[model samples]
Target: MLNTWYYSDAPRTVRPMLSVMRRQSGFAEIIGDIDQENATFEARRCLSCGNCFECDNCYGVCPDNAIRKLGPGNRFEFKYDYCKGCGLCPSECPCGAIMMIPEEI
Candidate 1:
């Protein structure tokens, strides 16, 4: 199951009215939090391609058990021995981090 509050499978909705709001407010640099814990929290929002944040969507959704969980902070590994190349992991990825490539012959 996905956390709907944090994860969204569908494309983000566009807010056309936000442009009018922006025009009224003008553009400004919104500084991010400088605290370490706050920074780490924000870092979790990163896509983390070729890396991992242990979101577990892949590990939870794989039908073939090809994605292995290596515990917290260790990330995941693809178990080619059991993988079927279903393309589901990359498809379900919310952050657009994973990409598919053709195998070299």
Candidate 2:
């Protein structure tokens, strides 16, 4: 099994933030909202809010480019043809929409 970390009574998972300039831009693109290291640390801290606001974190962090942007408010789709189950989507997903399930070899 891949190693995982757990936190208790620790700091909360910092929500993906938009820069002040971006915020003022009204609809800013938050592609690289969360970093890999930051995402890993926030695993246990995740709020599991269960809402995909379509921040595009998965789109940017996907190394395989498996995620497809269906346009504004359309959400996204996974192209299994490209997905290698690298676990980046789930880790980068701000909302708990995407999750990783172990595939038996």
Candidate 3:
């Protein structure tokens, strides 16, 4: 049940372009629908494991004080203000917890 409003505009339909426009629109609709369905399924599969949403696995292990303890309700806040991105937190997580995203260069 994807909403079609998210799709980009159909291309211009000139003499030689009409077929291409149709094909592009069809492909866009199919891809968008499949992606929407996959997203819905993945959202349903999350188990919400009892571990803390902000489980301080990284906070406890960081040697450099890079990760900060923001008073938590959910989701641990990282103080990239000083994080060296040593990749320690992601490595130490027993549940495949944190992921190390690249810092902006």
Candidate 2 lDDT over residue span 1-105, tens digit each: 211231145674566777888888788665446677777877756554766767788899999889999999899999988899888888767667777777677
How well does candidate 2 score on lDDT at residue 2? 14
> What are the runs in model 3 whose C-alpha is more than 4 Å off?
1-54
TM-score of each: 0.53, 0.51, 0.43
Q: How close is candidate 1 to the true structure, as a TM-score?
A: 0.53
lDDT of 3 at 90: 73
lDDT of 3 by residue, 15-89 (tens): 222355677766543222335555565554443343335657678888878876768675566787778778887
Off by over 4 Å in 1: 1-51
Top-TM-score structure, candidate number: 1
Write down the lDDT of every candidate, Cα atoms only.
Answer: 0.65, 0.73, 0.58
Comparing 2 with 3 on lDDT, the higher-scoring candidate is 2
- In angstroms, how far off is 28's CA in candidate 2? 43
C-alpha lDDT (0 to 100) for residue 98 of candidate 1: 62
Ranking by lDDT: 2, 1, 3
Candidate 2: lDDT of 33?
Answer: 67
Worst 10 residues of 3 by lDDT: 1-10
